[model samples]
Target: MKRFVGFVKKEFYHIFRDRRSLFILFGMPIVQVMLFGFAITNEINNVDIAILDHSKDASTKEIIEKISASKYFSVKDYLDNENEIETAFKKGKIKAVLNFEKDFSKKLQTENQATIQILTDATDPNTANTISNYTGAILQNYQELINKDIVTPYQINTQTQLFYNKELKSVFMFVPGVMTIILMLVSAMMTSISITREKELGTMEILLVSPLKPLQVIIGKVVPYIFLSVINAIIIILLSIFIFKMPIAGNYFLLAAETILFIINALSLGILISTVSASQQTAMMISLMGLMLPVILLSGFIFPITSMPLPLQVISNIIPAKWFIIILKGIMLKGVGLAYLWKETLILIGMTLFFIAISVKKYKTRLE
Candidate 1:
């Protein structure tokens, strides 16, 4: 028994000497817990949209004010005519447009019915659908408010319709999510293991001692995975088009470019994981145990981020997948180009830069 105990102690000492291994074994669990606990949410907020109020009356103005006040929407612009709606959506800055028919106030009082058109950029079908539903609920509540004082039986009836994804297909929502998962699996997780394999085999020491800079070496390793990820993304797009009958409403080139950006982000994260792990096994464990849940739960892929706890909603912003998914929905489904999606694109780019910077710093520290 003493001999067995001695062997166990020896193994632990060996493991402890490798700081990366210790971090993987002990530190990763905490990261996983925090990510899943604080970042997974199901609610949407501060959605940017346009308003076209043809009526320009007291009732319509009141409804617009109520919508503007809601946490779910931000009225970014007011359109002058129906012709401007398409142009505004094509610009991509707007998610949905609210059009109030002319004489909206008078119609509510005289005809007991008023029409409000909710025009959603349904490239992200789920988000568009949610915005439409929320608008309907808000309108319904407003109906109840005005009808409350009615001495006789009278109610303000509002008609709402969904544009783009009029069918509300659930599959449209998950396509981008699945593509993201495939990319992460092929790019980030694989890149993590590839770099750690060199570390495990001790070849990393030779490269570190060589004249080539550490960042260049890391890039060289990650480039192949980028190609592989792009190929996987192409395959996903093809399947989505041919089998799922998904429409590419925006620029195809933009979709491919954004996908590459997302792949780079995942690759940088993988490289960071490799820098923190001493063995391929450790890297794989970190990639899977530390990241998979966050990618799925916190990315707004499966669950809505807005309905989550306040802290979790704030944390969800940190997940690169969340931004990528939004970009995917925009470019693929909404057909909106860079104008509407630059913010989300910037977020992904920023994350990639941050990960690369951290990895480079860590690599230099190890060299010293």
Candidate 2:
């Protein structure tokens, strides 16, 4: 017990002594959380819209007033003709253009409806869709106001329930994803490179020649990382709970168990990387380039896997972070138990076993 405590103390000393590792371990989570929370928002606000009201009538004026009043859009310019619409859009200042027909009020009074064209820049499809929906809602509100005296024969109203995150804040979604990423990076990448550093520095030979078995040596190196990673995970969770107000609806014990499983999986992957890499630099590069990119891009962290290219979608299936993120979301956000996330949990377990098997095989070959 004393020896283990001494080993842990040494690990802490090594971590604290290196300013870069300490920064990455502590600073990265806060930086990523703040960046994702503020910069990567799904909410559409103050989208610049151009108005092309050819009508010059009361109805068009009212519709324009209603659109501008809403917080979703700001009227940036007025287009006199069709030629101006293209120019305004090309200038990149406007995201959408609302065009009222030439005789909007006259047509509406005579025919009961007038056509309004909503031209949107679909470069960013999500933003374009949101802008279109906002415009549609404004038009519907205007129609409802004008027809206040008339009673509808049939009315349909939708009350959408956004479960888990009632406010639909993107932070709620990003929190678990970011946590998974940070934990994976610290547990896998750093541990892998640290282990390989011993080999590169020729210290691994000295340890191997000593009384310690290969398993004990490997375990000693990894155990400290597991402890540190758990502490880091706790810090991240506390930050999310207190600072972000992220809810933890599921059992704390279950969450802890799942987190341990993920940590084990990541650490095993680190061992596999350490076995394969010839140097600390190689391990670091592979962990960052190979593991981090897939975790960020393909793990449904920043981009939805459902919307990815078919091949990339298939590739995402193998990433451990992808499954971990899903499991974390299910437990943390949906308040689901093991029964709900068992498949993903099992997959993670299987991956951990596979990685451990490969590392053991590689280690045996090195021994022989």
Best by lDDT: 1
Residue 7, model 1: Cα distance from true site in angstroms: 14
* Every model's TM-score: 0.80, 0.59
What TM-score does model 2 achieve against the real structure?
Answer: 0.59
**Per-residue lDDT of 1-368 in model 2, one digit per residue for the tens?**
99999999999999999996887788767755643444345566668888888998987888888888876788989988988775565444576788777788887676676788887654334555677677778777778788777654112121222234545577776888899999888889867886688787888777666786666666776788888888988999999999998888778999999898899889888988988998888788778866876788778676545444456668888999988887776667657678667888899999988987787777667766
**Count of backbone collisions within predicted model 1:** 16
Q: Which regions of candidate 2 fall more than 4 Å away from where they truly are?
A: 1-157, 210-214
CA error at residue 181 for candidate 1, angstroms: 2.0
- Give the count of colliding residue pairs in each prediction: 16, 0
Candidate 2 local accuracy as lDDT?
0.75
* Stretches > 4 Å off in candidate 1: 1-49, 66-77, 87-94, 148-155, 306-310
Q: Over the full model, what C-alpha lDDT does candidate 1 score relative to the true structure?
A: 0.81
Worst 10 residues of 2 by lDDT: 153-162
**Best TM-score goes to which candidate?**
1
Angstrom error of the Cα, residue 121, model 2: value is 27
